[model samples]
Target: MSDRAPQPVERRLPTEESRQLVALVRDIVSKEIAPRAAEEEEAGRFPREVFTLLSESGLLGLPYGSDHGGGDQPYEVYLQVLEELAAARLTVGLGVSVHSLACHALAGYGTDEQRAAHLTEMLSGGLLGAYCLSEPASGSDAASLRTKAVRDGDDWVITGTKAWITHGGIADFCTVLARTGVEGPRGITAFLVPGDAEGLNAALPEKKMGMKGSPTAQLHFDGVRVGDDRRIGEEGQGFAIALSALDSGRLGIAACAIGVAQAALDEAVAYATDRRQFGRPIADFQGLRFMLADMATQIEAGRALYLEAARLRDAGEPFSRQAAMAKLFCTDAAMRVTTDAVQVLGGYGYTQDFPVERLMREAKVLQIVEGTNQIQRMVIARHLAGPETR
Candidate 1:
């Protein structure tokens, strides 16, 4: 016990439904998820039980409409749940985001009949889902993907490899982007490809630097058959759908970045109080104190940026540029916070004995995924100019 006051516990205010949902999520995370995060993350084990708990609690469907067995919650409320979940366990937070990405095709563009049949399961099922858009050749330039889907009368035969899918091996379904025309994005189409479809397979998991518990792999669709009815939207609308999904998905990544940063800050503050140096707590040192202050400030600013973006979305304002801004800023903040957290702990932070190292590793991916920071800057710059010049 060093003489630092107990860290203040403040939460963002929410609507009545959001308040109830947040409280329930907090309880579940504290009692169930937090205790196991370390073991599962270290062992690279997926928390299937946690996924079941989230579904049963109806958290998985928070952003969808009540008609689809979802909570009909606003983006504002739903993103807060994501922030809270990320605070407890990054894996669960990211899993939710990936699941939402998988469902975007259905929610945004699915036919009424398709929505009637799969929306509920997409939202509340214990099974996870993946978004398949990237390829070996088309990462930042997703529009240039080469995976092909050939229409065969009543069905489409898809043949392509989707790279860097978050829930690749374990997902129950995948929203796939495949090239159907000869040109660029105009040639692409989106489809709901069942995970168990014939000729569909996931490669063995890729060994990643972080987010070990969440699986990543290449999804191979070799002549996988899908009814034309399974097409998510009109041909050539895939690019628009994908971009719109990213507008939301970027916010999710921002929320997770904030959570990772907060975790690192929390660990740093705790360590500073307990660690002794020069006959007093290390926290009392001006050097360590300044670092903590900076970390906290970054986290606060990052939170504000994403919240503003979420508000813009809820208000039906143009938010694509803002979403890009939030994702770029918060993830950069996360990388800094986690790295400084390791510094605050000195030698111990460099080792696996502490969670900060893992958090640091996790932060890197946020910058890479959901559009790289470079791509985000490009998007923001283009938006800053008028359409003619852009």
Candidate 2:
């Protein structure tokens, strides 16, 4: 609602490098990404160059080991960068998060030779990645996935379709989970599959309600062949690797949610201050003022929740339950904040001329991505009351 740019959020950082990193990210967002976000998104154009820019800036490898070419920043720092990007443009923020998710399996579980050979390229050599886990029939019921990978000689043949992949068609590589043995979770195995490998095909991107700048598609791995050397961790360990990655990925989603919510609040406040009704500024009214107050409070709370979880992760402590709570609260908060932002703008917010409408649409996906808020609550419940028996 103010003509001035939203001030940078106050963040407590552990090091000078992180402080500088956040400043650099804000500069890039204001100059390069934010300007084109509305136009590119309306055209459904993906910002491939932005990813290149992020890669070159060393942002793509932030939470990884320096030995493997990462920036070696803590998860707290990495997620704040993601939040800054998401506020400017959610497509870039979410894309970066998904790329990090895609890299998690190999970075954490692959052999030394695998790390030396592929991790450098994935982390620092300007390549993009995707994570494959959900399937046509297994969205929340991931352990029941039907994708099969049969062993043959030193290579494995993979055949299955992965649904709702963020960078499905365009990723340079994919960290895939496929069934290699028994029927449940233990049957699964993780692999690093090249995007152009034989029999790997991505379907047309799905038409979405918002965040059109980012493509979502289904990938078909039809007997795709990958060498055994690409296998990550041991047989029957894929599900664990996938879940571990998700704990971190959920944090990413939470940060992005806060960013979107922040953006919406900014827009609402700016509009309210400038727009006048009945001979006075709408922001002068207590009703709108209270709404804005609530929105800002929720955003701050969500940010604190996610950052707390991230710190737990950086400490190498158990944080799955906290991660789930952050994901649940942040995303739901985004949804609520964005919806209220639209109401704050009244008729103007409902129209495409305002970014609030788009922000509202984009916020919906945050609730669904990584894991749905409903699923997040389920995970939290599991942690609190133990697992549910069928």
Candidate 3:
């Protein structure tokens, strides 16, 4: 064998098709999403109509295969679209992310029969989805989840509570991870549970600090019966499937973080340029100018990281580390940028008059959800130094 080491393959830059997709998304964001965001935010109303509009535009299935009615767009393109949506409304962005996470089990590991029955509606309709993995006890440590799924002849009986479910009360379907074997990660299995299934209930939505339009509630499966056909992949593979989906889901969060930061920057730029102080626009002040520059820089950097991760995913490379890094860096950037954006608006930023306050609140949840920044740090640390360092 030759002694020369293998060279790393560089990812291709965004192609013409990708650029077109981005432009189309920008148009949709500007024309359809941007105008209604403020009204929806004020009313604390979830954007079912907007989602329906997106579905009609084929955005809901942006990254899936065309054979199943998906748009078959690249992850990079899909994430950019998500960034645009998030810039308009965090709830809508989150709805799309949760929907993608929900699609993972069915797309990656579902049997043909299961996909035939559900994937079509999931890809082509206004219906949304929720991923049910975290329990009251298991958030980052999902392998320790307590939900149970017992085989009952022709059906599987699922019983447990899933906590912090996005779209919990409003989703059309949920992909739930439940334990089938003895206690441990290996014991877990995934099941596709319909939202309207008997014995399944969602608690009243939780009061949250941000992303108010997005509902978060506890999903209770009390002896919920599902057909054996609804089980995704092999038994005892739920943990692996969940982790796989999370690896992908982290990119969505990273993109949303970028969007939040970008929105903050946009608001700050608009405000600073307009709001006068000391006989000049606040933006004319060097101090405010530097803050805006910093916010812009951070958003650009975060966007770069998430796009790199998405590129690695599209290239079929090992991307877990990249995804974790993107999630960590981008979310931290979002927190910082949004905080600075608030400072830019001064007192107005502190109040609900502008969107900065909401942006800040939305930025916070990006750090917590789709694996907390703490968990992200752990993941990145492990990747850098190896598990033996623990």
Give the best candidate by TM-score.
2
Better of 1 and 3 by lDDT: 1
Residue 37 lDDT in model 2? 93
Model 2 residue runs over 4 Å out of place are none
Q: What is the TM-score of each candidate against the true structure?
A: 0.96, 0.99, 0.94
Candidate 3 per-residue lDDT, tens place, 1-390, comes to: 123222211224367876666677778777877787877776778878888888887888888987777888889889988887898888888789889999989998998888888897898877789999999998888989999999999999999999999998888999999999978899999999999999999999999888778889999999999999999999999999999999999999999888888888878888887888799888899988999898888888888889989989988899999999999999999999999999999998999878899899889999999899999988998888878532
| Global lDDT of model 1 | 0.88
lDDT of 1 by residue, 91-128 (tens): 89988988987898898899889999898888886767
Q: Show the colliding residue pairs in model 1.
A: none
Kindly indicate the candidate among 1 and 2 with the higher TM-score: 2
Q: How many residue pairs clash in each candidate?
A: 0, 4, 0
Model 3, CA-based lDDT: 0.87
lDDT of 2: 0.94
CA lDDT, candidate 3, residue 20:
67
The ten-residue window of minimal lDDT in model 3 covers: 1-10
Angstrom error of the Cα, residue 316, model 2: value is 0.8
Off by over 4 Å in 1: 1-9, 386-390
Q: List, residue by residue over 1-390, the lDDT tens digit for candidate 2.
A: 457566678999999999999999988998999999999999999999999998999999999998998999999999999999999899999999999999999999999999999998999888999999999899999999999999999999999999999998999999999999999999999999998998999999999999898989999998999999999999999999999999999999999999999999999988988998999999999989999999999999999999999999999999999999999999999999999999999998999888989999999999998888889999999999999998
